[model samples]
Target: MKSYSVKELLEKQPVGDVVVINGWVKTFRSNRFIALNDGSTIHNLQCVVDFEQFDDALLKQISTGAALKISGTLVESQGKGQLVEIQTTDIFVHGKADPDTYPIQPKKHSLEFLREKAHLRIRTNTFAAVMRVRSALAFAIHSYFQQNGFYYMHAPIITGSDAEGAGEMFRVSTLNPKNPPLTENGEVDYEHDFFGKETNLTVSGQLEAETYAMGLGKVYTFGPTFRAENSNTSRHLAEFWMIEPEMAFYDLDANMDLAEDFIKWILKYVLDNCNDDLQFLESRLLDEEKSKPQHERSEMPLIEKLKFVVENNFKRVSYTEAIDILKNSKPNKKKKFQFPINEWGADLQSEHERFLVEKHFNCPVILFDYPANIKAFYMRLNEDDKTVRAMDVLFPGIGEIVGGSQREERLDVLQQKIKALDIDEKELWWYLDLRRFGTAVHSGFGLGFERVVQFATGMGNIRDVIPYPRTPQNAEF
Candidate 1:
């Protein structure tokens, strides 16, 4: 008999057909029923076997979490629990998992416990479902961009320029940490570093992706981005994946449309293809508050929410208007924000963003034309001379998942902004050349991959969605 995948067997409904299945035993009950899972899906394959068919010695060693191969006939399961089941005739043991040592048992384990054993966390129902969703979302991301005629570009991991100018970067150097290369003034000599003249992990691929987008017409980069910030929070991670899509001849409105459409497509793909996995998560892993009603759990349930976002126009408010609203709102009615929620110049905190999308707008809101002082120098400055054409898409559960803006295509304007900001103009010669040669109205945005995963799967914490999460003061496994 040929080996069959769990997914294929379930879909084919091969009742009365003989098949061979191999996987690690999730649970072995009553010396007859065995739950086998290959990490192919969240749901495991349940098997029933006769004690007489196997040797007593082999049966004695077969325990929970043991790897096994079994040949059996597929049959309709009578139990209300499972769908397709196998009646086993022959059983072979490939490996054994000691119950005493294996941290993942049949019992319910908290997410905190799973985080400690990041190496083996995928064995649990929640992590398994999360991993599946993550994979599906990644495929969806590529599919959406490729279908829309966007070239995928790979940006350098180590670069000389800080794209975000956030000053949070992991220095890349082979020089000694103590008594390193120093200049005449006793300052660290970046010229002696590995890449020479200082290099650090990429904070964003936007600027590089723009170079290709301007040439290719439309380009996007999907890769790992590093940020060495020390804040320990549910959202901040030392290393994360980002999706940045840039396009030529596109304006701020067009950029917002792309973000909305792309997000909807991904949510639809996950809800449609990962139904079984989502259901497993909803019932066993996700919290009760996060679970949906039985009727709303169907395919595209989340997609419907996203569709509402795409069909309805998002509220566009200038940074000035947002500031006025915050300043005038009654203090008693306003929720406390981490950073002061005052006006146009201050960075929008998570609480303010959530309030705008979840309360004021009652949908995903696109806050555009932010104060130039708070935005990057590359953003196109509006005629008002105060705000730039920047947009931050804030969703209900996740705040500011997408951040992008129309680039300053005018070379003179860009150069002036760079000089005003005191940025090294020499290093950005190539960037300035793009504007000087054939500058066109262009826009792009960067979406946090982990945030999208958290939104799609209803995962509460950023740590739960990413495998081997790299966070501040935490790099276990």
Candidate 2:
């Protein structure tokens, strides 16, 4: 008489109780067994029915992908696969899916094929487990920040200032594109736009989160961020979620400490809470790697890889030292790197970061004190003036997992850096005011939510982890 989720029923194992369960039919076999799932858990509920008791017409309605509600008495399963199953006494068909037309069939479907059917892909075991783990990780992120005395802040999605200064942004305007207002010099005038000036989607919330951290002491933002870069790679996405935490009175070293500890805590939470989903994903990864050569496969199991990170201390190396190691390493010297690490100022690519984590150190590594020219304008300038107090946490196979820095707090020094980059001081006047009024040593880092999900789930493509991935020339779902 009471409806129960498969997860709850499985955990409680209310044997001999009459229970009502609502779910979509995964499979109907031999006119008796029905595999049903409600998207609450990865495991399906085995529903056994007596063929002679029900009309053939009613039994015909129970097909794969059909939504159904069934009331039955739960009993210990005589079958070996699962512990309990339902003895169906009554049935109701809420909806039916044509087996021929349903995109999500019982057979194996490619990840590429599933992406096209993004709306219904969650019905699959892989995506359902992935999304469940992703949901748990999101909760873990907020939990860590809240327990450590940090306030959650919401940064604006649309803004006039460019945080990254790369200038690749999706414009936000209500003006007519075909024929809009013009300036005196004949350029498109943004003065009369919706916000009365040019605005675009935010790339990072660090700048705005810094303002909140100045007053709040510790604050974090978990929200959507956009980038208009035209990258169609498996590792890139046009839109993604970022988890950024800003802390007042923290230096770059402290920032690195927080990043390492935060990542470990959230990962451990997933290991404990989402064991069923994680076990499924781990087995999936092992099967996926079977086609590849032995050298290409991961040495450790998926869960072990996560545990390795949580158990080990992240190796800390300066940018100069990392450069030295890469320069002398077999890959760089033998031209194995795709983007070769030539000099200290060269930005480290995914290959280089992977080398440091997977091959060189065999653990997570934190590289710091990047060259000023390669980093953004906001990082604190070191005493030598050549490098900024910036850091990036490199993970096994994932490369850069987190990036942050000790922000430039000295008003004069920050102004000099801003002028060197030729950024509009007027646009960032409010940001500069933080330093003018009550600036202290502050630091923060951003971890791409998708990247973390990819690593945790052992998902190969960045697109597979997100619900609806936005990529170059692709927004279908």
Candidate 3:
């Protein structure tokens, strides 16, 4: 018999047809019913076994997590829940997972426990569903960019410059660690390094993507980026994936529109493609949030929250106005904020961003026109010289989903900013050449891919969304 996936067998195909399926046994109930899952879908395909026809040795080996190939006649189920089931006529055990020794069992395992067994976590329902959605979201990302006339660009993994001045970066070195090459003054000699200079993993691909956008008119990059910051928080990861899109001749307003549309498109794509996985995640989120206080829990369920974002327009406000609102907010008035919003140009924290999205606007909010000094030097300076054409899209659970701005296209302006910031002009000579040659108004944004997945799946920790998270002290597979 031709082997078929559990998902295909469960579909409304011809009943009574003999079909072969290969999968792991989720459960063997009363020695007659076998719940089998093949990772094709979240739902399991029920396999009915006739114990009398099989030897006790084979029956006893049909344990949870056991890999098997079962040939059976698919029939309409008379059982309570599922519509289709398999009457097993043959069984072949490919692998046996001892229930007592297997780390994953058919029970509710803690997320922390699952982390230690990251390799096997996919066998669980929750993690499997999460990974399915993650995959779907990734496909949606590529689809969105491709349909919008954006060229896909692959930025070099190893770079001699840091794209973002936000945090520390992981240095790429080939010199001997203990007795490294040193200069006459005892400083580490980077001239002897593999790249002939000090290089590190790219922190962002925005710079390279901008170069492509200058010529292609629109381009995007989706790749892994690294950082050396030692943040062990639930939301921070040392290694992460970033989605950056750069567009030529686009202003800040156009940039914001693109971001909003791109996010909504991905959300809708996941909704349409991964319905079963999304429903499972929605229920999982409800159960996980049960331990929290009523006020702290999300108002809408996971799927509803996603739909709400897709259906509504994000609220837009200026940084100056947001500062005013924060200064007057009840939390600021009662001195409940950890970092008080006492003055303009103060960087907003996660708490402040969440408050603006969840409480103040009760929707996604795009805060723009941040202080020039606080933003990157490449951002366009405003007329007042106090603010820049910067914007951040904040969601209810994900504080900063997207950050972008209008590029400083004028050659003189960019040169001045580069000098004032003390960045090596030689390192960015090609970047400046884009401005010197034929620079038009351009804009782009970077979205942390993991953060988007975390929000869509209602996952709390950023680590959980990624299959193998790379955090401060955890790199084990």
User: Tens-digit lDDT track for model 2 on 118-211?
Assistant: 9999999999999999999999999999999999999999999999999999999999999999999998899999899999999999999999
Which regions in candidate 3 have their CA more than 4 angstroms from the true location?
A: none
Superior by lDDT: candidate 1 or candidate 3: 3
Order of quality (lDDT): 2, 3, 1
Encode model 1's per-residue lDDT on 82-113: one tens digit a residue: 88899998888998888788788898888888
lDDT of 2 at 40: 94
Task: Using TM-score, rank the candidates from best to worst.
Answer: 2, 3, 1
Error in Å for residue 40 of model 2 = 1.5
Best by TM-score: 2
Query: lDDT of model 2 at residue 442?
Result: 97
lDDT of 2 at 140: 99
- Models 1 onward score TM values of 0.93, 0.99, 0.98
Report clashes for each candidate as comma-separated counts.
0, 0, 0
Worst 10 residues of 3 by lDDT: 5-14
Best by lDDT: 2
